[model samples]
Target: MRARVHVLVKRALSVVLSLTLLATINFSAHITSAEAKTRKPTIAEINEAKKKEAEKKAAADKAKAQLNAASNQLKVLTAKAVAARNRYLQELKKLEIATKKAEIARKKEEAANKKSNAAQVAVVSSKNHIGKVAANAYIMGSGFTDFDSILHADGPQDLMDRLSTLDAVGENNSSILLRLKVAEESARLAKIEAEEARVEAVAARKEQADATARVAAAKKEADQARAAQEVEVKKLQQMQDKLIAELLSARKKRVTLEQQRQLAILEEALAARAEQTDVKAKVWPVNGIGFSKGRTTIRSTESIRTNAVAFAKKQVIARKPYVWGNEGPNSFDCSGLVYAAYRSAGLGYPEWDRVNSRIYYSWTKRIPLNELQPGDLLYYSYKADISTIHHITIYAGNGMMWEAHNTRKGLLYSSIYSIPGLIPFGGRV
Candidate 1:
């Protein structure tokens, strides 16, 4: 009975195992049918998908390229904006000079008018005095005419006395006439001077207007450049904030580098100056020749003047403050400093002559850059044009100059290249 029960159990197990195998086969067949329905991609289809991916990457690269171009454009625009601002500042300086010139002309005209009025008064007074003398002679009938003096003689002695009296009267009349003539001549010269001053005043006013217009134009250009730069900055920022920040940082670095270069130039100039002999006169170089230091054993008149000018400059170098239009003992401007130096050297206009940089530039005899000497004037211009000259300083030999640079900088002993807009030629007074 146990064997029969075991065989029956084994047969039941066998039947269960066969059914499990059949169910596994049916599940495999369903999986294979599903895989068959989901077919592998074709070569053409794969290539098409890859092409779409490449196009997507290319579009992304194109956008990146455009953004980079915009970044560069932003940098260029910022540079242009800075340049435009510099130009505007230069124009403003010109306007200030023109306005000052107009003011000077007006003052001169007023003074000339006053002189003319005084001259006219003198002329009238002289005429009235002469008329009074003639009227007194006619009314008193005391030798009023030569014919009367000859006719009213009583004796030889009386005739001689009458003739002497007529001679005295004639001398008085001649003196009065001479005074009237001098007064009239003075009035004529005064009128001429007044007219000339009036014409100068008119011309100065017109120049002021022209300068103002140029300033306006420069300001407009600066404004436009600033607006364009701002717009570019905004666009760049919107595209990528990091990129614009980097661009700005780069610009700042360049500026810092430029400042460093300027400082280096100053240092080099100082070093050169130190190597030079203090008491010796420097023979200025012209075309790479004659840059020698001469001893004071023999000094020419020109050398003495140069020394005086240099001394004057040294007296105010760091001692005086920079004032916008000042030209004096305690403070100075750029042109004012040079003016004061030359005046001290007895080579410039009077103390009351407060001319601007443009006037000073006009008075200069332009010499080559290599021919600059001590006491020579250094003129600076905007865009290297003589017409836009705005600053003046004195060359202090050895590639150095003395200037009342600005309010913040005050007076400085600086290198020739320390300032911007240096012209290739220097001015000889």
Candidate 2:
């Protein structure tokens, strides 16, 4: 019984030492993580991204303004074109009236010339007939000679009277022939004047015809001009439509890019949060009094092992300076501290040798964070802008965590909110 009691006492002492060690290491780790999170990004990078986003939005707005201006201009142009077309139509109507007047003037002049020509022809024919009648009458009067009349007379006195009468008749025939010749000359002169009038009328008619043709040509040209204007108006309308479509497409593209960027940012924030929550749920194995190293412990009949390799690293890097790029002993980066902590928890540490790695696995799919059992790997990001597993802390239940961080603070206990930008993501060994 003495031997058994001694053995029990020794085991209890061992348990106490183990529990104290685990608690000390855990506390130190939390302090380190909290300190590392305090380090921040340079102001230049932040300002540059903000400026870029602002410039893009401003450009989009300017394009929208330009599009509106173009649409207004198009409307103005359309109105002007419509007014011009109406004016052209009015002018065309005037030209048509002028053309009709010119044609009527031409026809009247031609008819006057035709009537003058007919009058001249009739006068010429009358003169010719009068001359011929005078010649025939003169011939008949000459045939009645004075010698025959004297021979056939009964007495000398009767012969004398017959000669006197024959002489008077010859004189009358001569007078009639002279009058007929004069009348023929007058008729011929009238015919010549009529012909001259006819020629003048024909010239006037030709001038009128030429004027009518000119008016027709002018109207045709006006019509052609109106058609050309219509075509130009159509082309301008099509161009305006095309420009509007292009503007709309550009605006749509800009909106889509903005939405995509926002979604990406939100997704990144959620991913960081999930990783930290998983890290928080992880439990280190304790051997009755303290955490055990190099051995599996049973709690609630479930066997568990701390990440022995990670444990060794923490021991090696405790109190290391918080260097941005340092990975080991005398100095540590954010991810380095987290990596070391996980190893100490007896979980198989993934080979996240690079600062940027794609290690997205859902530990909660099998074991939810709300029902977090022991031995889960609670992950986190010190700089949320950094990769998902930039820094980590072990979750001790009740809103407490442990981490190893910068040499300035070493390992310590930390509340969840102690790290300024710490976000929780969860994983399992």
Candidate 3:
């Protein structure tokens, strides 16, 4: 019995040893896997990373190219829209002038017809009077020829009176004939005048109709062009948004790889550029009219100008929305914002209130680009002419500008030099 128990105990110990060896083997395998995961990547893996980076860069380049193409397309469309709108306005003016001419022609036609009718009536009346005179003369022809007045006379005075009446009737009949002749000529001339007036009225009406049609067609074209431009603008905005997202992603990755000190300097520069402060009584870095020693020489206009700039900057900081033709506390267009800012600053353009960018262009005095000062009105034209000026913004100091840029950008501060279609001159209100 003792020998059997010893063999069984040895078998149990062998089983326990087998279990311990298996646990050691599993722990060693886990350690090997952990070390493999923590090890640096191989050259092949580094090459794969580089390939991915190159692919991302290629995608970025392609997107940038697409953005540029879309921006150019937008410029073309904007020009088309502006031209269509101008054509429509011109047609409206022509329509107004034609309508006035038609009205005048209509009045002239009425007056001419009335005069012609009166002259014709006179001609008929004169003919009837002549007929009555001829009938009386025929009825009394034999009696009058046989010395009837002398035969019917009672005394010398009576005979003389009868003879005078006879002579007066003869003269009266002759005068009626002459008047009738004159009336006939007058009626004929009046008829010609009436016909000429009728022709003029008809022509004026035709011109008015043609003008109306042109105005309608012009308005339709303008609407279509505006709609197309709006659609392109939306598409351009989407592309820009996507590009910004991709840029942000790439920037985040770069920031992760860049040194901490370098990142700090970059952030600092960005922050400094974005900083806004009051300019009241401060030395502005400007040289031009009303400026002396980097300070405003004219205090009378200085306060007003600075106030306008302040008002515009406040809206920009508030991120006001851009709305076409809007002048408000909520939203504004480029010219609307400028008008409102100046109006709020007590430098109101009463005569030119709510006018377009072109009108604003005329209201300002030209200053060279190098002499730009804060609160100066900046103008831009696609055709580089005053008549085609389409955009206006207030100049903020340090080469920056405040503008209600567009639907996609809203009210924002931007580098004046970087924008497209910049005129080399600015305006001082």
Model number with the top lDDT: 3
Off by more than 4 A, model 1: 1-60, 141-143, 240-429
| Per-model TM values vs. the true structure | 0.39, 0.30, 0.41
Query: Which lDDT tens digits does candidate 1 get at residues 63-173?
Result: 567767776876776676677667667766766776676676667667666765766676677678777877888787755676786777787898899789878867876
Question: Candidate 2 vs candidate 3: which has greater lDDT?
Answer: 3
Arrange candidates by lDDT, descending: 3, 1, 2
The TM-score of predicted model 1 comes to 0.39
As a whole number from 0 to 100, the lDDT of residue 257 in candidate 1 is: 50
The 10-residue segment of model 2 with minimum total lDDT is 286-295
Name the candidate, 2 or 3, with the larger TM-score value.
3
**Residue range 98-176, candidate 2, lDDT tens digits:** 5565555556555555655555565566556656655654675644466667667888998888788767756755665
Each candidate: what lDDT?
0.60, 0.47, 0.64
Model 3 lDDT at residue 119 = 63
Question: Using alpha carbons, what is the TM-score of model 2?
Answer: 0.30
